[model samples]
Target: MDCIANLASEKAVVIFSKSLCCMSHAITRLFQEQGVSPMVHELDQHPRGKEIEMALKRLGCTPAVPAVFIGGKFLGTANSVMTAHINGSLNKMLKDAGALWL
Candidate 1:
């Protein structure tokens, strides 16, 4: 959706999350620990949260929270993110997306 795209493109790293979701928190913490300040949207607190969640679902996000976008592109959910981190490709992706200087 245009709304999601606009928000995602506003920053090098964007995370659509729910404030109470543990996975969302984990993802946020991971980015912070990596020294990347990502733009995070707490969907549960957003006015159009329900609509946005639906949009994410339509886009193939099952849980619909902790959806990540990097360089204005949709990356996968928590599992994929964790995989990338484990494989050490997360830092490279962050650097490529301008979310990290190192």
Candidate 2:
């Protein structure tokens, strides 16, 4: 959890994800499509992934993987990202938060 927080703090955009998760892949694709290069942390591949999972649950995510963060803050899950994209606010949010220059 500390590592996760540290990485999030260091990066403009961060994604805590599992490599094999479709939602995670979708989130990654979404950012790429928008020209944002996020720092993706594949928790499932890490030794402390389960600990991170527990930490995410504490952070208020139900299904924690694919959690998004911007400006060192918890943003939301993939569903939130999708909703933000559909409503046309994700791009603006990313731009305003300095996650995307575009």
Candidate 3:
């Protein structure tokens, strides 16, 4: 929880993912294409995976891979992220999160 809090507070964007998840890959690609290098937390390798689980639970989100946070707010799962991107809301979100200068 502390790590995630720190990440959320310190970084403009953070993405939590597991290995080989298609959704994760897609979201990663999108961020990369937009030149946003989000801080990535690989839950599978994380010893504190339970903390992430608890955090998700507290946020009232289903335990899913590729959960994203911007400016300390839970943005939701990969599908939501993709939808935001397609709707042209992601860049604005990033900007609001202070993840991008422009």
Q: Pick the candidate with the highest lDDT.
A: 1
On residues 10-102, what C-alpha lDDT tens digit does candidate 2 reach at each position?
777889899899999989899988888898889988888888888998988889989999888888998888898999989888888798875
Give lDDT per model, in order: 0.93, 0.87, 0.79
Q: What is the lDDT of residue 3 in candidate 2?
A: 73
Full ranking by lDDT: 1, 2, 3
Predictions ranked by TM-score, top down? Answer: 1, 2, 3
Lowest summed lDDT across 10 adjacent residues in model 3 is found at: 56-65
TM-score for each of the candidates = 0.97, 0.91, 0.83
lDDT of 3 by residue, 4-96 (tens): 777666677788887777778778778888888888887778898767867866776565668888888889887788889899999999988
Candidate 2 residue 8 C-alpha distance from true site, Å: 1.3
Which predicted model would earn the best TM-score?
1
Residue pairs whose backbone atoms clash in candidate 1: none
For candidate 2, the 10 contiguous residues with the lowest summed lDDT are: 3-12
